[model samples]
Target chain A: MTLHIVSKSPYSSSALADCLRTCGNGDAIVLIEDGVYAAQTGSEKLQDFAGKAVFCLRADAEARGVAVTATVDEIDEARWVALCTEYRPIVSWFK
Target chain B: MKFTLVVYGAPHASEGAASALRFARALLEAGHSLYRVFFYGDGVHNGSALAAPPQDEQDLLGQWQRLQQAHNLDLVVCIAAAQRRGLLSESEASRLEKSAANLATGFTLAGLGQLAEAAAVCERVVTFGG
Candidate 1:
């Protein structure tokens, strides 16, 4: 499975949306840097990621003062590395 | 294991390129074989031969060139992205009627298919940039 990492904000670019379109069911999406904005409550961007596995970097979320929902898994640096090991073809979407 | 790196950020302007460079170095140090390093989007700027940074600052373009030479690495810049950013090779400059080409040494312009092929064959593909 591919691990799609989106580090750009949904507001600023279509990186997240573009990632969702190509990512498969088994693929995972991890939000980092400005991408933590998409994990905020009531974000329309969250709706697009409804059924897929979504994750947010814990450091990024805390830095942005955003709360991580139950639906989104908050991962640390070690967990991020673990995810990379578990998955292949780690794709990063940014613009 | 064979690995591929896809970079999407410009050098110096963003941390992406630096991070990728460090990671690539570490990967090699750890005995991992790199299949390719694909530059896409703004990452194409990393291949500009005209970039002249302050003498005191790190020359990221030069660093990449040295790394490519030392490792015998395949450094590919996406043709579509490179063209969009006005980074041209000798042939591309001739074809487009541009005055000169500024693509840095050790980097070649290719299609996105190269990325696809790398992803398909490499054991892992890591991306750096946002």
Candidate 2:
């Protein structure tokens, strides 16, 4: 499984949408940095990632004072590291 | 495991370059072979030989050069990206009629194909960006 990391905000960049378009089954998505913004409540982008293994970095969410919705799991740094190990070719999508 | 690192942020303006440098060091320490360090987008700025950071600050460009020298690392700057950012190799500068070249020592301007080749062979491809 490839760990696709998105670090750009959907509001400002198309990295998230582009990443989703190329991502396949069994692939995991980790939202970090400004990417956590996409997991916020009422975001239209969240719907596209439903049923996928989606995670957001808690530190980024808290730092931005964003309340992530239920669709995504909030992960700490340790979990992030674990995901890196569990996945291969961690791909980062940025603007 | 062999790895390829894609860096897409400027050295002085973002944490991406520094973070990538640290990660590269750790990978080498762990005995993993690095296939290449591909600089894309603003990451090409890391290859600017004209960078003159304060004496008190860590010289990131110099550190990268030293690392490349020690490991015989393949440091590649995307030629298209470098051209857009005014980072020219000696030949590119002459071809473009630029007065001087600013690509740092130990770095070569190459096509995106290098990145693809690295990805094809490396066990993992990690990216660092702003």
Candidate 3:
């Protein structure tokens, strides 16, 4: 499984959308930086990630004042590192 | 696991570079070997020797240099990207007839073939961008 890291905002870039187009089964997505905005409550962007593992960097979400939705797990830096170890061919979507 | 990181954001301009730095530190602490940190796009600016941010702001390039010194890290900046951004090494400056060199102490200018080799050998390849 691949770990797809999205660091751009859904509103500003096609990074998340582009990533989803190529994302396969059992892949996980981690939202970082402005990308955490997609995890905000009531965001329609979350629907695009349906049935896929999703996470948001806790520090990034808090710094951006975003209250991450219930479905997305908030992860610390250590967890991020662990995810890297778990995934093969980790990809970053930053546009 | 051995890993390679591709950085595409310049320090302070985007959070990606800072996040990459934190991740690099954590990976080391977790006993993972960093095969290389390849700087592409604006990431090449991280190797600029002339950056002088205010004292209040973080000296990100300096931090990278320190980490490189401490660990003997392989910080390679993409040659094509570095030249386009005017980030020249001493040899490059002389070759290109530029005014002076601005590449920092620890970073080396190389080609995309290095990235290809890294991806082929490293267990994992991650990217950080803004």
Candidate 4:
């Protein structure tokens, strides 16, 4: 298992693309920092990975003021730690 | 489990390197081992030996050097990217007729095969970028 952290905005960075191409099931993608931009409501790119678990860091989302109502989970730093510890993922792609 | 860290951001440009460094330290603290840290694209800048930060500030380059020294970490900078960016080693600098070379002490110049090998060897491959 592995967790991919997408730290760049979706429109410009190929982070999401790399994650989709290389990541397998039982993996996760966390949108943090500028990556939260990809989690906004109605993100077309996110549609493809609807089956994968998508998470956004609450701190980054609140700081960036990105409004979203997607079916994704908003996770805090504590949860982030928990996710890293729990999954112990095999790969994390950031862009 | 062993982990591989790929850095695709330059030092002092964004929070990517700092964040990755912090996460690497944390992973080590958690008793995890790092297989390698691959620097590619703009990330090759992290190995530039010319960086000189203010005395009062935390020199990130020095931080990486210290971290690698302490942990015996594998710091691999892409040869293609480094050459393109003019980040030459002593030998490359001399061969290319450059006056100086400043790639960091701990980092090595390797090919993409290192990245592929890292993927094959490591249990986790985490990337840090812009």
Candidate 5:
């Protein structure tokens, strides 16, 4: 499965939406930088990706003051690297 | 696993450089081998030798150089991108009749073929800066 990394904000860019559209059911999405805003609670931006895994860089979320919900796994940089090792065809969606 | 990093953000201006640096270190700490770091677009600014950030803030360019020294990291700045952004190496500066070269010590000005080759060979190509 591909690892889709989205680093743009859902509010400012379509990066997450575009990535989600191209993502397969087995693909995973990791939100970093401003993209971590999507993992926050009460955001309709991430209503998609029902079956796919979603993750947020914990440091970024905390830095941006985004309270990430349980729907997304808050991971550190090491786990993110581990994810890169476990996955293939890593795709980055940024504008 | 082998990995390549594609950095598209400028240092100090965008979070891409800092984010990519942290990720690079994490990748190395996890015992993964980094094949190359291809800096394209504004990310080429990370290779500027004259970037004098304040003593307080993070010195991203210096950090990248130190990382390169530690791991012999291949920091490839795109030729087209660097030229457009006025980031030239010593050879390119002299060849193009420029005044001085500002490309950092460890960063190499290369073509996009390096990125393509990295994508073909590396197990993963993680990108930063949007």
Candidate 6:
């Protein structure tokens, strides 16, 4: 099974970075909640994973009034469910 | 299939804990079995016995207890992290001669080996943090 990571924590950024370092070129990184902040458009850290599918929550983005500039797709609750069902990813919710 | 949840955030500091709780409920409702819930790093604070939120706020400890009892969940608090944060069980508290043990019931102290075991046994190990 492909491990799905919702990189949402600032603390786990290093760990997330560590995780992505081993990306087999088929994994995805969904930046939800506070994780959207990590995708500051042209951030070098986020650049590596841009080739993979990157997602952010639309509600969270609007709440923060920050436009996600990365190659990030938007996900709502229904879409979230769909992704989970389709991928059955091992979700890592980072704060 | 079996899954293990690693909670890495405090109960109130962020939504990580609440989200994890919600996901656990969803997983159970969807007919999935949980092997364990490992509390690591700042996540151990969620199991502290001294936390007292406002009256309206969800009693996190109570919620964890309820889920644990109902699901017979194996809750493990990382001993290294707990000690660093001053969270101890009754025995550890007494052995260390601390004022008290803040670890709640339905949870036990364990090491990183538990994490490795979870990784090996469970089909997926989900982590909630930040």
Please tell me which model should have the higher lDDT, number 1 or number 5: 5
What digit string (tens of lDDT, one per residue) describes model 5 on residues A1-95?
A: 89999999989999988997799867889999999988898888767756779999999999989999888999999999998887787888887
lDDT of 6 by residue, A1-95 (tens): 35556555444556556656665566666666666666666555566665777777676667677577747887664454345545655556442
Reference-based lDDT, residue B96, model 4: 87
For model 2, the superposed segments whose C-alpha errors exceed 4 Å read A6-85, A93-95
Error of 4 at A84 (Å): 5.0
TM-score of each candidate's B chain against the true B chain:
0.98, 0.98, 0.98, 0.95, 0.98, 0.96
**lDDT of every predicted structure (CA atoms):** 0.87, 0.89, 0.92, 0.82, 0.91, 0.75
For residue B98, give model 4's deviation from the true position in Å: 1.6
Please provide, for model 6 over B36-60, each residue's C-alpha lDDT reduced to its tens digit, 9 standing for 90 to 100.
Answer: 9999989998888788899998888
* lDDT of model 4 at position A17: 85
Model 3, A1-95: lDDT tens digits are 89999999999999999999999999999999999999999999989978999999999999989999999999998899999999887888987
In model 6, the runs with Cα more than 4 Å from the true position are A1-4, A8-25, A36-95
Model 5 agreement with the true structure over B66-114: per-residue lDDT tens digits? 9999999999999999998999999999999999999999999999999
What is the DockQ score, from 0 to 1, of model 1? 0.31
True contacts kept of each: 0.52, 0.45, 0.90, 0.39, 0.94, 0.42
In candidate 3, the residue pairs with backbone N, CA or C atoms under 3 Å apart (3 or more residues apart, or in different chains) clash, namely none
The per-prediction tally of clashing pairs is 1, 0, 0, 6, 0, 9
lDDT of 1 at A11: 95
What's model 2's lDDT at A36? 91
Worst 10 residues of 2 chain A by lDDT: A76-85
Write candidate 4's Cα lDDT for A19-67 as tens digits: 7887788888888778888888777876766689888887778888887
Worst 10 residues of 3 chain A by lDDT: A86-95
Worst-scoring 10-residue span by lDDT in model 5 chain A: A43-52
lDDT of 2 by residue, A1-95 (tens): 88999888999999999999989999999998788999998888889888799999897799899999988999876566567667986988887
**Candidate 4 chain A: minimum summed lDDT over ten consecutive residues — where?**
A86-95
Considering chain A alone, what is the TM-score of candidate 5? 0.96
Residues B1-130 of candidate 1: C-alpha lDDT, one tens digit per residue: 7889999889877767875776678677767788999999999999999999999998899889999999999999999999989999999999999999999999999999999999989888898883
Q: What TM-score, over all chains together, does every model reach?
A: 0.66, 0.69, 0.95, 0.73, 0.96, 0.73
